[model samples]
Target: MDGSFENAAGQARARVALRWRRIGFSALVLGSCAALLGLMAATLFVEAPDPVGIAMLLLFALTLPWTTIGFWNAVIGFSLMTFCRDPAGLVAPHLRSIGGTEKIASSTALLICIRNEDTGRLQRNLGWMLEGLVASGESRWFHLYMLSDSNQAPIIEDEQRVAAELSARFGSALSITYRRREESSGFKAGNIRDFCERWGSLHQFAIVLDADSVMTPAAMLRLVRIMQVQPHIGILQTLVTGLPSASPFARIFQFGMRLGMRSYTLGAASWQGDCGPYWGHNAILRIAPFTEHCHLPVLPGKPPLGGHVLSHDQLEAVLMRRAGYEVRVLPEENGSWEENPPSLPEFIRRDLRWCQGNMQYFHFLSLPRLLPVSRCQLGLAIAMYLGAPAWLGLMTLGLLRQMPIRADLGALLFILTMVMSFAPKFATLADVLARSPLRQAYGGTARILVSAFLEMLFSMLIAPISAVAVTLFMLGLPFGREMGWSTQQRDAEGIPFALAARRLWLQTVLGFVFAVCFWRVVPGAVWLWAPFVLGLAGAIPLAMASADPRVGRALAAVGLCRIPEEARLPAEPEYATLFAPCAPLSPTGATE
Candidate 1:
């Protein structure tokens, strides 16, 4: 009785502490956003604010919360990375209690959800993971389920052959199951649901993986052990980094992503605590709670924004939280990876799908019994896509309004905004450069700096292009324009010039129009909008060049934008073939 009372008291105290952390984090984010918005208001209304100026301020205001939250996350993350002994442990104390020798008593289902995908690549990723797990002697505690929704006969046959090969290779060392659905009713979520209904009872936990996801056995063991020890956690998401890619577009894009994600995730996890994000894949879920309470609701419509939830991860997280379970992210970049889109066109296609799915979150904002943070998360997801249109609106309005302003203050504000916008990447970059080990891991200071500079340029070019695409997609969401769930092109194939031109014609035309208008109306300040204009104007060529095989080869040859995985051989011999194409070239032009 006394021990129970002490335990209850400890829980109470922890709850109070968490509440305070949430309050403090909220105060910081809201306060920072308010201050920035005030500055923008002052800048816009220096003279009496007209309707256009007011509209610009409103749009600018809309863009702030996301940027401010990200900026603060980066700042806090950088501080932790620089100052703390164990930054991830500080955020997730449960992780500190995990000793590597812990027994994996809990049964975990490794669910690899796939659509029509490249089975060869899938086979390699799955085989390595299974081999690692088997070697760890924890194969008995885990099961592999290849849940496929492949409609193509060829791909389906390939998936079967791959599954057969893996089964034959592993023999009885690991349990492997392959299931395919004739109709992908709920898309990926439905596929998962079918698994839950059929075999979820067999496992205590599920580590969800996309077709492109690959996790080392050690990482899988860590997640399993953490879940085994901490039964209260519903979801534990790993910080999945991009795999080394030979594609120039993917390399540069993921390099920027790698820089930003570390700080952003760490900082967000610090405050988000139990209300952390679950990014669909590369995460472990408590099967019981996830199956019992986290079933997705079909929205009241058809396709796109309606029917089955496309962005099912967050909603599942919310539901799990509502069921009184902690949803968390392990912010350390361990041996977990996923392939990014190989080119600009594929990237846009993926981004639009997310945009469409995020827009569906509007229906859940008013959900009952949800924690405030959960609602805020849903709102932020919506705002993420909404900010694209808001940014475009601000630019369009700025061009049209051409309001008289003090150049120095305006420029200062613009600089501040840009700094905050890129703070996550900058924060992680600073951390990387500050540590000698990190610099060496990334192939030294000179290479890191060069890669970062080039990546910055790539980011600037891609941002406006993505924004325009998202804005256009968002505009069509209300009119029944659906980005259907389809097989993603994962290969780093060169995009044809005609294909690029066809896809980005609107962006190019809009860029030309903006340039003409900026020159005619505000020629003196045309440089102010150069980044956005040039990105739009050169959208087609940029897409083609970024996706060009020669460009990728050139970048690879020079060791530019190389990730750590590319600099050295993977610890596991099985990954050698996978990383060979991404490996740095020797002085003699051979792969080092």
Candidate 2:
């Protein structure tokens, strides 16, 4: 009884420390945003403060929080990466105790959620993970569940076949179960709910994996061990990186993402602490709490912004936290990865879906019992999509008002904003260059520099295009523009010019219109709007070129935008096999 009291007191003290840390971080973020907003207001209103200028300032204010948060997160992340020996351990203290030899005491269900995916790829990924787990000598504590939402007859048959093959191969060494829902009621969330009702009671933890997700046995073991010791943690999300891709779009996009995520996640985790993000997949959940408390509520409407919650991860995280459990992120780029969209069109499609989902969070802002941090997270998620429209609105206002004046302050603000926008990637790039092993892992300083330069250009081009797409989509949400749940095209494939043109014609036209308008009114300021205008105008061609197999092959051949996983064979033979086809060839035409 005395020891229990001491433990409770210690926990109370820790909670107080965490609360103060949150308050400090909140102050920092709010202060930075306030300063930036003031600067933007002064820059706009100092000359001839008009209603249009005020409107532009309002839109600019909408854009400040996201950029400010990112900039600060990058700053904090870079400092930790450069100065601390154990940054991940510092943020996620539960991880420090995991030494890889912990005895597995809790039952964990490896939930692989699928909906009409490539069966062959699924088999290979699962086989590799299962083999690794068996080799780790802890297969008994883990069970594999193929929870399918595939309704198509052929795809269902394929899923069953793959599951049966995997079960036969593993035999008694591992347990594998396959369950398919005839009607995918709540989509992925519903599929997970079905699993909870059926088998969640049997397991203490569930390591959720998307169809495209692949995790090394070591990563899984580490997660399980952390959960065993830190019973307070309800969800633990791994820092998921992108797999080596043959697609030029994916290669460049993920290179930037890889750089940005390390610093961004580390920084966010430092402040976020227990109320971290859950990105749907590549994370582990405590089955009992998740099943009991995280059942998503159907919104009080119809399709689009109603019905079931599309972005269930964040909601689940908040719910889990509301249940007095911690939702944390590991922040370390361990052996966990997922496939990225291979082309601009696919990327836009996936992104817009998220936009629609995140926009739905507007309904839950005043949700009862949610922590302040939890509410802040939801607001941030909403603001993320809202920034696109806000940016476009600012652009529209600039074009309409055609206001001319102080170039000095305008240029300074522009430069500073751009710097803040790209801080995360630049921060990580600096850290990588500073470390020898990291530089070598990413294929030396020269290659890394080239990759970074190209990726920066890629990001500039993609950002405007995505912003425009999101702006248009959000505008159409009221008229029932819904991106219903569907099977994503996971494999890299060429996007036809005709298809690209059909999809991106509006962006193309809008780009040219903006360019011509900016050129006519403010010819000198064309350089200022060049990135956005050029990206919009060149949308179709950019989409087509990025998805061209020849372009991908050319980039791969020269080792441009190569991830570390592509430079050297991974320790896991399975990863080697998976990445072999995408590996760069030597000058002699042999795989290097």
Candidate 3:
């Protein structure tokens, strides 16, 4: 063989080796967690509970299985759904394609929500979308609105300045309104609700965008046209793909999310007109249904979690569905994108809120109005969020009792739960293969296959740490602190590897100690001894996007970029590009 051929083969082997290394590491971690959980299952007492213990266990029991089972199921089940070749969607398509129209027609409203945000970046994204909308000749029908929740008596001037500038720029064609109150309440939902009440009265519908989300002109109009046509649809949420930056972890996940989430999103969005959940971003909604039907109650309690639904989007979908409205995901739409958190710390901060909110779904699990598929989805979220702690608790109890690993119902559920969570990963693999172009995007099927083990390994490492975090939060809930609605960490500098490693050290230590303690007491199943301990120490950064430097090289070797390539857009000035292509909004001879 030629020396060049030999070198290339050697490099390929190295790639495969690195991928397996990560996978093995992950399996070790998961095996330990499952083993510990199995041990715990052997010890659960079926004895009658006193009122107090029964009440407490009632709270824990409802939440525990959902967390363990649901978490794993989403990861795995969604993975399978993504990979499957089935053409059926869970929801029926509501909007018909109106391709090749260049007329100034359909008047849709654009809603942009902001709260103490970087105005420049906000302006850039808004401009980006506006330019696209106008270029596509949909601007005449599309009015832009800047909804604000800035309430500083002092900095109020700056907020007003920005809003005023935006209004002046758009004039009567673009409507920009700002609502700054002394006391800001209800978070994003509150802000949006307030806007809907005031302006939702004016427009037919609005396409809502997160501060960082960049929606293309075509996507915005496509979403609006669909919502306009599908009157029963309260909110049309899309499957948001991550636009990763120049970071190791973000790039890999960008590919993972596209393949992992897109097909399932398509499947979920297609259910019997029963939209599973709206993610509150890059989706369009009719003004009347939302304003009239989407009033969020300030729940009685303080927040890490009181006073409102933490998972507001899911609950909103449920309420809408209950009120005889249609809520769903739009998979065929494109150009709506978001950036992944730059680091591990930021990632966890975002997840904690999800964990707390999804767990609250137990309160509505039995509601009769929701479709079976939607309910299954709600249940899935609960399981995914609470997975770690429940598994750990069962493991802890089993070791204390010195019992053999039970092969009964509980054990089966534990395994099934995990399979559901991760099944999505394998499915994602299958999805990439079916679509040949995405293979070019991901480097190659050759590389992707090699990378699966590393991906699996990443999952195993994060599970225990996540389990502990969820368990602590669940246990800590009686103290009555609500996890507040925190802004995500976007555009932040990445934490160094050494610092990130130290951050997880505490978790690693505790996981190891607990597993060892259990192994000493109940020495039978090696599964019991493997994952938890691995998970605990694996927190050093196995699954973390940026953890494996080899993965980083692999990503770069393929010319894969996470954030949207700027060259994809033209270099014309904002307004030049903004409305240049949008056929001049001919007066529809209609008044708003």
Candidate 4:
């Protein structure tokens, strides 16, 4: 047995080393492609005179600068040592160690309010985080509260079971509370309102957590300290690091996110300062400020047109700012983590809700309180991300028309945009390497390089899937069903037939449209459409990954499918010394 175990370990190490070598080689190949593309674009720009040529030239120019950025971000986006080079390094850690900060023990109750959530999965997430906190020596300083909205049969039982279990173990140190609701009057916001009115005065602050949210031990501490020192900060939300289950598509995505969009979020917040976008959950709030000043106003109207703010996060931030408290994002910690929709269908469903909320932003842009310079920065952030679809739309429409549009600067901007999009991932990866003991596990250098290439390939394929998904959701809004406060379903790769069909069909139509235009129009534009294509191709695999990866039956092993340039990729080690708190809760059957 000893001989066999040693042999296995030896094999793993060999594989990891080979993997890094592959990574280096892949990086060289990609770097060469980007450099050559940059040269081509630069040379073309100097010779353009015709309108069509100029437009293409401009487009190329816009793209090249970002190519450099995207390439660099890909290189270092996941830095291991910086405690997350993306956004957490910016604020969470800073607040954690700040001297004047006071610990608000029991004074603040961090609530993990839920509706129809799987108690087993909830316990797992809650367990991991709280354990990390206790191991880090913060068990006594905080209290955990859970609010449930399960009114139905099986769900209510599971929820009660979960609540009772948690209440039993940490009865005094931890508290689990559940509520079905007096009525569905205001939806989720109302459920929370009742909590505040009932127990609001007992605690100075209440950290609101969604069912899917997971926080690092330190992330929770920083939130409390920040609330303590910055008395006027009504909400200091962080840019979340979303982790999905497992599979080629899921792993690639969960990891790639920090690489791509996360940096932009970090940069946007850093550059803009006080005007960060509100992500709703995974944030801290003062009870007095929220209840007395931040209560949401009902917009006078009916279905889809009006009701309590569906996008309450944005409204909360705007209201907080209006009430003289600063609403900001602290990147210093990676305390709060959440789940990303593993597949395109779920992603679009989630986005539909956002679009409806954002559509309202267009209306509120003129509201002085809603769009004050600090708050207006929030709107501007919305437009910056939203511009992606519009920009893609332009590329599509322009090609279909065969109209001569200038692409000179536009091309450069778009290229730089891609770089900005991907570079953060590289930086984030580097950070990850610096921290994980899996340094040996992830392979030496070759594997990282190969993984990067495969990662990029997968990213491109998903692009079209996402673009069309976004477009479809936007179009479907007018006739869409009234989405409610739904719980995230957890199962081992269980995607119902109806949901799968709806997604596949929509993707097929969108891909065909883009493909036709790509063939008929300027062939160059198809590169920009990489987003949609990559996504559609990877849809099936992503769907499979969303189910619990631990369940073991993988549709396709993400590591095996790509990155053969390396031998073996690394896996995260269980750092037991780091987490010993959050002993499993006994759970209760009684409702609070």
What does each candidate score in C-alpha RMSD? Answer: 1.6, 1.7, 14.1, 12.9
Which digits, one per residue and each the tens of the lDDT, describe model 4 over residues 1-592?
A: 9999996898577546545544553465367556655554453445544465455444443333334434543443233234444344442333444563455454767787777777777887777776676576567666677776666789778877776777776666655566666366666677678888988888887777888887776667767787776676778786676543433344455546644554444434433344455677888787888898767667766546466667667766777777777677775324456766655556656766666666545545665655345554455434533544554554554564443444665576556566556667656556545644434334435555566666777666665566565555556556744554555543335565566666676665555666666666656776665566545544665554443343222322323222111122122224221111111112341111
lDDT of 2 by residue, 1-592 (tens): 9999998998798778888877887788889888877777777776668999999889998998989899989998999999999988887787797787878999999999998899988998999899999998999999999999887889889999998999899899889999988778888899999999999999999999999999999999999999998889999999999887767898888889988999999899888988999999999999998999999989989879999999899989999999999999988888899999989999999998899899899999999999999999999999999999999999888779856646678888898899999999999999999999889878789989999999998888878899988998999999999998888987778788899999899999999999888898778876689988889999988988887766777787877777778755655455686676467676775665
Model 4 clash tally, residue pairs: 99
lDDT of 1 by residue, 194-294 (tens): 99999999999999999999998999999999998888999999999998776789888888988999999989988788999999899999998898899
Cand. 2 TM to true fold: 0.97
Candidate achieving the largest lDDT: 2
Model 1: weakest 10-residue lDDT segment is: 566-575
Name the better of 2 and 3 by TM-score: 2
User: Candidate 4, which segments miss by more than 4 Å at Cα?
Assistant: 1-106, 128-141, 381-389, 404-414, 426-444, 478-482, 492-499, 523-592
RMSD of 3: 14.1
Q: Which ten residues in a row have the lowest lDDT in candidate 4?
A: 576-585
Which window of 10 residues has the lowest lDDT sum in candidate 2?
A: 566-575
Q: Which regions of candidate 1 fall more than 4 Å away from where they truly are?
A: 1-8, 570-574, 586-592
Give me candidate 3's TM-score against the actual structure: 0.74
